[model samples]
Target: AQSVTQPDARVTVSEGASLQLRCKYSYSGTPYLFWYVQYPRQGLQLLLKYYSGDPVVQGVNGFEAEFSKSNSSFHLRKASVHWSDSAVYFCVLSGNNYAQGLTFGLGTRVSVFP
Candidate 1:
């Protein structure tokens, strides 16, 4: 079984500051990892995903994530954040079985202060 863990339940950062959200996964084999963001009263949007190839992948709105197989972690990072970036971010893990569905972390709520 695959599972994800986001140690931080809440994160706060000043506008224009860099940010990193930690994510850890537990899976026996290579698993699909994804970061999704949910805005206030809106559906979740895909921030980035990693399955193979390069460890680093660029996402929308200056977001990016690095996958580390050795550490069993996929952490999301942003060079600089804006106040509008405030939202809830979820770390998800998916195995080969689609029917089993994806396992999601509790989520990290980010608050960007001006």
Candidate 2:
């Protein structure tokens, strides 16, 4: 079984500032990792994902994430954030079995202030 943990429940950052959201995972084997964002009254949208190959994956809107198998972490990063970036970010882990579905973190609410 795979599980994800997001320590920060909420994160605040000033507009144009850099932001990083921490994510930790526990799994027996190599797993697929994903980052998703949910806007107000909207469904979750995929930001980026890592399955194999390069550890770094690019996402929408200048967002990117680096996957570290040794550290068991996949953290999301943004060089400069905007007020429109405010949303709930979720870290998801998927096991080898596709039918098992994905395990999601509690989510980190990001608030970008002007």
lDDT for each candidate structure: 0.96, 0.97
Candidate 2's TM-score: 0.97
Model 2 alpha-carbon miss at residue 109, Å: 0.1
**Per-residue lDDT of model 1, residues 1-114, tens digit only:** 788999999999999999999999999988999999999999999999998999999999999999999999999999999999999999999998889899999999999999
Q: Once superposed on the true structure, which residue ranges of model 1 sit more than 4 Å away at CA?
A: none
Alpha carbon lDDT at 104, candidate 2: 97
Q: What does candidate 2's lDDT look like per residue over 12-114, in tens digits? A: 9999999999999999998899999999999999999999999999999999999999999999999999999999999999998888799999999999999
Candidate achieving the largest lDDT:
2
Candidate 1 at residue 61, lDDT?
99
Q: After superposition, how far is residue 101 of candidate 2 from its true place, in Å?
A: 0.6
